[model samples]
Target: MIRMYGIKNCDTIKKARKWLEQHQLNYQFIDYRQDGLTAEQLAVFSQQLGWQNLLNTRGTTYRALPAESRNNLTESLALDLMLQQPAMIKRPLLQRNDTFILGFSAETYQQLLED
Candidate 1:
């Protein structure tokens, strides 16, 4: 089964969910807000896709951080921060099998959706 992780209020997540439904794809939505995320899960995703791809530096959550914290963008540090604030991470991370696509996009979903 596919696992989609993101906040429920994000517009991108909304679009991704809509696309999945329209395509009749079955995916378990994991909202980090309510359910929260484990450090082990973060480490696994970071290893699979790297922290750079998982972190959303341009997001409002990132921008709101202190300049000093923002300046430090190391993988370990970023992972630690993201583990605390999942919202700082990218939205609609679609995990299927051993691979995952962070961030939402219909094109990516189309390519990965079950056929």
Candidate 2:
């Protein structure tokens, strides 16, 4: 089963969901706010995509962090922030079996799912 994880109100997540629906693909949507995230799950994603890739530095959550927290960040620090605020993680994290995708893009999604 394909699972898409993100917050419900995020524009990127909305677009990804629309794309999936338009393509008639079956997917399970996991809302971080509603479903909550676990350390084990974050670790799994980090292992698959690296902590840097999984972290959403462009988001307000990251911006609101102290400068010391953002600069020269370590995986441990990133994980702690992400655990405290799931929104700190990138949106539209797609999972299928052992494969995991960190963000949304029509071209990437098409290529990944077309196979």
lDDT of 2 at 13: 97
Q: Model 2: runs farther than 4 Å from truth?
A: none
| Tens-digit lDDT string for candidate 2 (1-115) | 8899999999999999999999999999999899988999999999999999989999888999899878979999899889889989998899977888888999988888866
Worst 10 residues of 2 by lDDT: 106-115
lDDT of 1: 0.88
Those runs of model 1 whose alpha carbons end farther than 4 Å from true positions after fitting are none
Clash pairs detected, candidate 1? none
- Candidate 1 residue 97 Cα shift, in angstroms, is 0.7
lDDT of 1 at 47: 92
Best lDDT goes to which candidate?
2
- What's the true lDDT of residue 19 in model 2? 96
